[model samples]
Target: MNSSLSIRSFAEYVEQFTSLLIDYSPKLISALIILFVGLYAIRIINRLVRKIMIKRELDPTLSKFLADSLLWALRLLLFVSFISKLGIETSSFVAILGAAGLAIGLSLQGSLSNFAGGMLIILFKPFRVGDTIEAQGVIGTVLEIQIFVTKLITGNNQTIFVPNGILSNGVIINYSMQGNRRADLVFSLSYDTNIKTAKDIVMQVMQNHPKVLKNPAPTVAVKSLTDSAIILAINPWAKNADFGAMASDVLENCKEAFDAAGIVTQPYVRESSKA
Candidate 1:
């Protein structure tokens, strides 16, 4: 009798298992189909997006990052669709995901902000790699723009990593955006020096420099008169690349020119023994 009872119990278990499989087979098959079709569609969409990015000449780093992010997001949506199609209660799962996302967002607030700022920068392109820019009280050539930070190489050759959040929100002076830059220089002359002669000498030095822009023309005007000396403001325009070199050369050449022309510069007098 015990043997018979065991055989009957085994048969009932097999019957229940078969019944469950039969009831869920169509749903399982439909879910599989949806998964395959969704994957194919995602692949096509990803390829199209990549092509658009390439055509637009977008930053490679930004393009790849966006592509991967989109791919994963699509895959996650597909997963939810597949599970829900199988008659599984997905509200709890979705709530769990939302809660987890909120927690992670709270934990990485700074990083997320930086990421958003980077996206804005990449899209708007206020500055590009190799451009000289001044921001956050640091002036440097942009080395690279990453998702969270931007790398810059200073004039002194020091590397700096500025968070994109601050960089995007701050005032950015892109020296390279405009092809030409104006240099403001001041030279002091003694009261005995002939103003016209000093101005002519400075103008000659600037005009003779190969890098100085000739169209806008350099200007020399008496800026101010102090008790000790007369200040002359010299404004010259040059290509951004040649600005530093041209400014230095013009100053040095002007000094030599002044000496040659017998122009008297203001002499520094020590007020006290300490200097």
Candidate 2:
């Protein structure tokens, strides 16, 4: 009879514990509902914030990052709220989140740097859209500037995507920013050709061309006498819009004049593959 009574008392104790848990079930249900509602509210708030930023003309990429970060932060807060509702301590939750963010930033330092560089480009208009520039040793026309990368269309019609961080640190040549540019031409002729005659011919060609600017006074002189040729250097300033056509025409004119005079000429080889 004593064994039976002990067993029955143990069973009653377990039953009471279970009933106690069931009685608190309403609190658990309320916590879950609060968590879901909080998350939904945060989502709505994020959308509204993004809309406002767009209306204010905030950069699109930056606005998107802000909205996503806000949403994640809100979800974390909702999680902390749920934990608190469950009668657990939440002081450490916020601290943990802070540490996590710091660790992530450290791990993604490169990406963060690129993001910062992109912001700089957008904030300061070093070169605007449709500018022809040389950057990172590649010469191209800028197509689009994004948060992480900038797109360029090369002279060969190839598409190039460059990270913003390198562009920020590296040397960039902006060729389209000036109103007028000087075309430096070094013409080579056989050492026996008369230097003064070549200069007169070049000057006459410059005068005939309508695109060449006369105010700067097209300069022409013998710069050097190489082993094979005498180099005649010429620098002419012209409106940016005339650079292409005038340069082509100048070379053609020089060839015709030299041929007519029957003056032997040396080939003008490129000293640098690119400038």
Candidate 3:
């Protein structure tokens, strides 16, 4: 009998809680309705902010970021207002929230660094989506630049997510920035091979290739004469879009031309990549 009485007394707060709300029924319901309105208004305002940012020519990534941040901030502010409507003390609530935020920030220091790095990327724009770049020791095609990480697809079919903090600080090589690219090909011939003949052979082959751009002209010069072969540097200017194609064509033509001209080519180890 004594245990039953103790349990009933301990649970009596539920009835009192109901009585308190009933006493302030009008204000309590009004505050809840205000909360709903505030949430709805935040949604509308978020959309409007996005539209305005787009109109003002902000970066698409930054625009979305601003919209999301604003929506959350405004919703929080509205929540405070709604609480105030229900007779809760706003100053005390804000103080508690401030303390909580400090704790959260302390726990997420690394994420904060990444977020700051992402903002820098948006502001400075080292590279964008679809730009072929080498960053953070990874060379790949950029797929997306999100708030915290960058997405990449490597040539070998691997997906990479690089943290913005590391990428923003490291060396980033953007290949597609230049309007035109030059293929830096080193063609080697026998040390005894006629220099003029070798130069003419490389130049003639580059000129004949349809994909090789002619506007900037092609350059062929004897770079050096090594113990094994004569190194001829072939720098051919081509449109950026045709760089790979022209590079591929040059190697094919050079091998054929060397065979036809009876010139000995460089060995495999000394061979340079198709630039």
- Sorting all predicted structures by lDDT, with the top scorer first, yields 1, 3, 2
By TM-score rank, best first, the candidates go: 3, 1, 2
lDDT of 1 by residue, 79-153 (tens): 999999999889999999999999999999999999999988988999988899999999999998898999999
Residue 176 of model 1 has an lDDT of: 95
Position 4, candidate 3: lDDT: 96
Residues 1-275, candidate 3: write the lDDT tens digits: 99999889877977888888789999889998998888888888888888889889987777877788888889888888888998999999999999999999999998888888889988898887777788777888888778899889997989999998888888899887777888899877776688888888888998898878787899899898676778889988887677888898898899899989888886424456897
User: Evaluated with lDDT, which candidate comes out highest?
Assistant: 1
What's the CA error at residue 62 for candidate 3, in Å? 2.3
Q: Please name the candidate that would achieve the greatest TM-score relative to the true structure.
A: 3
Query: Who is ahead in TM-score, 2 or 3?
Result: 3
Backbone N/Cα/C clashes per model: 0, 0, 0
Clashing residue pairs found in predicted model 3: none
Name the lDDT value of residue 186 in candidate 3.
88
Q: lDDT by residue for model 2 over 42-100, one digit each (tens)?
A: 87899899999999998655676677768887887788889899877787876887899
